[model samples]
Target: MNPTLRPRRLRQSAPMRRLVAETRIHPAQLVLPMFVAEGIDEPKPISSMPGQVQHTLDSAAREVERAIAAGVGGVMLFGVPEHKDAVGSGADAPDGILNRAAAFLAERFGDQTVVQTDLCLDEFTDHGHCGVLTAAGEVDNDLTLERYAAMAVAQAEAGSQLLGLSGMMDGQVAHVRAALDAAGHETTAILAYSAKYASALYGPFREAVDSSLTGDRKTYQQDPANRREGLREAILDLAEGADIVMVKPASLYLDVLADVAAVADVPVWAYQVSGEYAMVEAAAANGWIDRDRLIAESLTSIVRAGADAVLTYWAIEQAEWIGARA
Candidate 1:
């Protein structure tokens, strides 16, 4: 350990530190998550997630254009329907908000960017479960699979390039994949929510989608404590022909994201969930932190942990900042 071998040499200048950085985060590696509500004449602000809105079709398209201009990788669309049913019929209806929004983005963006849709029923179902329910008032796993398969076909028909199976239902990847293939949509890929946990970090998203969740998702989503369990979920998803696997609430679960990325042969993604964004914004608003720097740091950490892409509310904003830097 000679004094001349000290790390201070490399840390002597900002440019030197930048050159030695281990992970790189580009605007093109970020995906923006957007919400489109049916029957909304004007964009409705989500109070829980400040600056986020449930947009009308036109506004949604405008936002996508802005994101594209900012150089983001893609967008993940969520629909907030004007109606809900026990079976979540809107999830498969051609006229559903999600279906129509996907079509709009596809027709506008084409191959310029990837168009993904959130393949979940929470925003469409009356009870706010991500699937069909049983008479016993529980989420029926097998029944949900059927509904998800139908939803997948509907999304693919609406021009969704990738379907994000965020419900955490068992066998969902296989069911959706089979349905897409049967419908001759062999190119429609599946992004499996492999390590999604039942977390409090989803509060803002629930408000954004106007969720009616009366109970927790512990029955379907993974437990937060088990790292090995996360790996197991990724393996199952990969076996079911998933093109990508994801870990939700990325900041709190980087270790889990790392584990999933290690074994997943396909691309691995991480969702920087609503709460994560809110906390950073809140702290910055209070002048307790340097917001822009922290945002870049948080996103870079996820990339450093091996996430191929990150789903974030800050995608467009971050992309703009990156563009400015460039």
Candidate 2:
């Protein structure tokens, strides 16, 4: 095979390939998403997500410590309350599980790692919708914005450095930012889930959070068929004062992530959601794929597609792997 150029020259050795790698995954670019369940005596394993648990407050703190030691960039905390209400009042209560977990992490490792909280009502809502419902049972976008603002302030007061607005409410970023600044938390950051799509990839996440959702979220979340809409959402979030923009279900939405990253002035992130993790684990358990190698490859592809950071279930373990190689 004669050729003008041999690309194999650079792929001849491990060192050569690594040196010429266009994308690199690092420990500091990975964020761990954790759940702290209220009234639990111990961490409860999520059946759908193998090896993942709904942690108690104490267990969550210890896990954060370990993640910091592993050089993980940050942790995004979600709270699971024992009770749920129509308006999701627990979401803004100072004594709520998520708020308490945020405070605990901040007090122990505030300067050690970035402490972020999910500013959505779904986990705390009886109906399992991300926001309050109207008389017609439709999601009330304006009312949800108010709830999100209050939740943002509560999370900020609990020392969350970043608020992850994942509710898919209109003007949520602007409303939350205004509320934070009004509460004298001007420095607190907003990590908006700008391009979240209503996809089947969220199945495992419902089990992890014990969600009660009876229907879909297509009314608010972006449609999977629209790529341009994802970019528009990112631009809207940036204009609304979002510090970071994220695309959810990363593996299936790498194209959206790339488009968002192209024009985003702020950091762009992608979430390798629960279902994605579960599928990999399931395949690995069946001896179908190399788990470690797949993890590294999946994350590297997200980075190569233009994600500045990734929220992944494999954060801690992958960080350790990177460290081992280094």
Candidate 3:
């Protein structure tokens, strides 16, 4: 049998397969998102997120060190305080858990890896809203911006190089950026969650943060049905001085991630949210799928979709796997 084009010939060699692979995952493209509880002496396992924990300050530092050793790009830190308030005073206090975590990470691993912290009040707010409420029981968009600005300054002062504005309030990026620059933190960067949709995927995260949100976030967060609006938000954030723009729930929003990445002049990132991670892990635990293969494939798919970086629960393990292959 004679064939005009022998496609199998190229496929026959391992080196050919490598050369033709269009998408590859790297350790440096992955970021680990961690949670730290203020008063805990030991790490507490989050039942919803298997094998993940709410770390103590000491344990959080150890986790960051491990992530660095694993060659992960960075760590997104969330703090769980023992108290809550209407104004989320914990978010602005230099001695607060989030600030302490930022300071500790900066002091220890500032030169080794990028230190990022959640700059939102939901975890500290009694009502579980992103900001202080008004006389009316609504999550005030303008009011939230003020809180976000202060949170940004606090996080920056505590040594956070990147402020993750996850509050979903209007003009959040611009507000945080102005506050940072006004405080003489010209080097502080904003990673705006530009396309965050109000999704149930955040259930585990809410639990991890001990949030008691009284109502849904539909008031401020974008509805999942609006694809064009997602792009608009990303563009607006870029114009508002975001160094990096991100789409949340990466697996479910790959199209959004791709679109943003295509038009983005700066780096584009995605957050593979809690629900997506739990789904994969649950399937693997039940012997329904190959865990490592699926994890690598999912991360590779995000990369192929044009995400410059991915924030994932599997980041540490994924980084180690990619590094080992290298």
Query: Which predicted model would earn the best TM-score?
Result: 2
lDDT of each candidate versus the true structure: 0.92, 0.94, 0.90
Order of candidate numbers by TM-score, starting with the best:
2, 1, 3
- Model 3, residue 67: displacement in angstroms? 1.0
Ranking by lDDT: 2, 1, 3
Residue-level lDDT tens digits of model 1 in 239-275: 9999999999899999999988877889999999999
Pick out the ten consecutive residues of candidate 3 with the lowest summed lDDT: 317-326
Candidates 1 and 3 compared: the better one by TM-score is 1
lDDT of 3 by residue, 214-305 (tens): 88888888898888988999999999989999999888888998899989999999999898888888999999999888988888899999
Off by over 4 Å in 1: none
Model 2 is weakest, by summed lDDT over 10 consecutive residues, at 1-10
TM-score winner, 1 or 2: 2
TM-score (C-alpha) between model 3 and the true structure: 0.97
Q: How does each model score on TM-score?
A: 0.98, 0.99, 0.97
lDDT of 2 by residue, 1-326 (tens): 77979888999999999999999888999999999999899999999899899998788889998899989999999998999999999999999999999999899999999999999999999999999999899999998999998999999999999999999888999999999999999999999999999999999999988898988999999899999999999999999999999999899999999899899999999999998999999999999999988999999999999999999999999998899998
Candidate 3, pairs of clashing residues: none
How many clashing residue pairs appear in each of the predictions shown?
Answer: 0, 0, 0
**Residue pairs in clash, model 1:** none
